[model samples]
Target: MTKDIEQRLKNKDINPTAMRLLVLDFLMQQNAAISLTDLEKGMGPSDRITLYRTLKTFEEKGLVHHIDDGTGTTKYALCMEECDADHHHDLHVHFYCQQCKETFCLPNTQIPEITLPKKFRSEEMNLVIKGVCDQCNPD
Candidate 1:
């Protein structure tokens, strides 16, 4: 498991240090997008600064992508296989559960392409569907 995690980091062009390996492994184990708080609760009693740095590095390297799902906190999830250091092809819909405050990447749901005004230019885009997820929905 550790070897696989290390290899993933290396594949992303990131140095696979011990702390990076540990954080990447933990992130891979999660089923949903997570916040720094979630990671701290799940993977720590580990170093807070190291963990933050690891997450920042991953985001910069396109190993992961973050969603500002309007939950008052940013959530992060693993990027798709095609993501790389140059560009992230993560134009998928994000589902944000209001009750549980968990975010999920809906990989099958592609974001619709938009045509901007002639003077406008666009780069990154995120489409988040906010609702009560199955886990939080009672009905």
Candidate 2:
């Protein structure tokens, strides 16, 4: 796990610190996106301030992308590209299951393009689709 984190950070030109490595390892372990609180809980009793700073650094380096699902909780997922700082891949849709409240990335589904008003520049996009997941649906 540590090796995986190291490789990911090295690929992104990010120096892998202990905290950052642990955080990235945790994120990689998850099958879906995770919230800050979830990450903290997974990391045991680490300092909240440090975690926040680490997350901020990761976001700036494009190691992770934020996902706001309108659930009042911001989730994050690992970025697919090492040098994707300027080009975020959040254009993909996210599936949020209402029953389990888990968010899964719909890898094959691409987000439709939306025209912006004049003089407006779009940097990144966040599209979340809410419904029941297979585990929750059980059908």
Instruction: For candidate 2, write residues 1-139 as lDDT tens digits.
Output: 6687799888777889999888988888898889889988999999988988888788888888888888999888877673365656546888999989998888678998899999999876878899899888968
After superposing candidate 1 on the true structure, give the runs of residues whose Cα lies further than 4 Å from its correct spot: none
Which candidate comes out best when scored by TM-score? 1
lDDT of 1 by residue, 15-73 (tens): 99988888888899999999988898998698878788889999999999988898788
- What are the Cα lDDT values of the candidates? 0.89, 0.83
Per-residue error at 34 for model 2, in Å? Answer: 0.9
> Residue 22 CA error for candidate 1 (Å)?
0.8
Runs off by more than 4 Å, candidate 2: none
Q: List the residue pairs that clash in candidate 1.
A: none
**Range of the 10 consecutive residues with the lowest summed lDDT in candidate 2:** 82-91
TM-score of each: 0.93, 0.90
